[model samples]
Target: VNTHGNTDFRNLFSQLIQKPEEDLELDRAALYLAGEEYPEVDVLSHLAQLDAFAAQVSQRVTHETAPANLARAIADYLFGELGFDGNSGRYYSPENSFLNRVLETRTGIPITLSLLFLEVARRLGVRCSGVGLPGHFIVGLDDTGEYLDPFNAGAPLSMEDCRALVDRMSAGSLEWTDQFLEPYTKRDILFRILNNLKAVYMQGREYTKAVGVIQRMSIISPGLPSLYQEQAWCHAEQQEFRLAIGTLEAYLQEAGTPDDSKEVKDQIKGLWSTLSRLN
Candidate 1:
């Protein structure tokens, strides 16, 4: 009896750890991944341990300690005692993966972790809020109302640092905007999660699931032109020409004048022409 439970938990953890970050459909995936089996001990017990550790660290932090110092202390606790492997530099969390696994299960992880280090800046108490940034989820510490990223692992960064990180992640081709730095609501965070899922589905050639994710995103962020474009592409791939045309048109209406706009219009016109042929 114990063997079956142990095997179930192992399988669940394996699937979760192995699932690509982009493809995580929290509700559906979590159900499927966690459904197979669980031990008498709750799976979230691991997360609870992290929460307890964070609470202990949070208590020791003060307005006098520098953010960097606090970060180092917490990192040591996490890596040394808690068994989290701090990749080579001891700076960032697990290299390319966003910290969602810790974040999703431990809702307070981001805010608590950020608070533990925010003791450095004396000007004001920093309030931590989660921002679902494109390609990543980050914590924003409101320092006397100024939003700053704490996920850089205690390193103090200017707005330029944020842009540089985006550029690095985008392989230097994309430009960052002021919009990227603006604070996002919890609703925006959920959409970001869905968008991430869409990317994974598209990559895996799971067009239906990609479309479903994009559709959900559109409900939350109806004004985002790129979401419509993605939906159009998904529909086109499935040969749903009329739906694709409608989606492309909607994107064109929202997308303003630019080289990208011209290119998009050309693509839309071509898609429409293709649809006409099919009709």
Candidate 2:
């Protein structure tokens, strides 16, 4: 690997070593990947390889002699059968881009892939975990007690790859931090799914559904102020001023002061005034 690749691998390894053993639940990774905070599921892993991994396990279960044998077979398949090729580059199914596939399948594409990987690793008795890195989902497995990325089609990465990925997707203002490389749980993964749906709905101009998704997100991450703010915006668009005002107030109380606080607060005041007129 090149300098960049080496850096990415080191960073990934550091992240895996830092994760606590108990927080292996996949849902936690989902929520964090979705950009929501779920403190109850403190693990910081990704759910990215689930679909491919799961498929491999199912096939093995059907034909393999036993679960123990299946695990060994899987390890062999991942390492020996599918040897890492640096020149291969990234692979996406020709039939689907990441975004299009996720959007079209709705429930299965991304989530299934992550789950598949997790199942196979579990069967193999490997100490693997998911890392829900910002803007991407991926897997990390313990090789000699160190975390290695499997989503690079089972290739090893350096810390630079992890940092580059973080820098590539962030809003350009947020700095990448080592804290971001930690592992997360299964519940977190669910929240990530809902958040991704919300983003899609918002982008597609489907405000009502976005609001509904935020509502579900609130159930998953009740402490997040942004979810309430998003719901409030949806209500305002629908002319439900009272509901909008209530949500805005809740958001302001929790979110505190930010560069956009003044505008949000002003919008809240305007909505309250409109609500008074309606009453």
Candidate 3:
């Protein structure tokens, strides 16, 4: 990646995060995240496509359309007409995590599908938001208190169904809690998307990509000390010892004697010794 391009994206992403929650543009932020891997992505063109989707939906509904009917219409339009569905076969594919790919392929995991649903709903004046369930994600209609599972052909889910979904997804290990159904803020959604990317990159042994995801996470949660540790791990995996040590030091500075301080100090010493031997 070009250093100038990196600086420009950082500044742009930081500005997006600084916006008021109401004004934070989730679609723009999401496309920018996708640009990390697909640097040539045209964000505006994708956004315009979303506009076209909303325009079509507008023709089917009037200003007085009920929220429930509106939700159904959107589900039908997106899933039935567009054929957007979950990519159950390759759930972990990095493509499933990127909005642009999801738009083009009409297949994505729960979060990306839910994001697409939310964006289309947003354009139509619907108060829909993402419900970040453990091991699952869905869209919630703020007006009707209903949840829609975009991954499952936009199936409308009752509260009981949602609880059962959590049970099944976790094999009953996670206890049901009302908090699980709470709507995630735009920033929270962005963080979750990055968190998914971080895992996929790490599992694929793409340490550099994992580090990039962590850097973006830092922009969203600047005071998050654990991010420094995670980034350091990625750097160490890539054999960037000095960079890893600096990251760990920054972790210590932000964490200020976290419980793992002693272990971290030992790790830093070991890295330094390795660096010396290399010299």
Badly placed stretches (over 4 Å) of model 3 are 1-5
Worst 10 residues of 1 by lDDT: 90-99
Q: Write the per-residue lDDT of candidate 1 for residues 152-204, one digit (tens) a residue.
A: 34444566666777788688877778777676553444455455556656877
lDDT of each: 0.50, 0.53, 0.89
What residue pairs clash in candidate 3, if any at all?
A: none
- Model 3, 179: alpha-carbon shift in Å? 0.8
lDDT of each residue in 70-113, candidate 3, tens digit only: 98998999999999999999999999988999999999999999
Candidate 1 similarity to native, TM-score:
0.47
Per-prediction TM-score, please? 0.47, 0.54, 0.95
What local lDDT does model 1 show for residue 66? 65
User: What local lDDT does model 1 show for residue 186?
Assistant: 38
**Could you give me the TM-score of model 3 versus the true structure?**
0.95
Report the number of the highest-lDDT candidate. 3
Of models 1 and 2, which has the larger TM-score?
2
Quickly count the clashes in candidate 2.
59
Q: Please, what are the lDDT tens digits per residue for candidate 2 over residues 7-122?
A: 33234333433465464444333333223221232223323344454466567656535544444455456545654222223232221112223223322333334444555576
Residue 114 lDDT, candidate 3, scale 0-100: 94
**RMSD, model 3, all Cα superposed?**
1.9
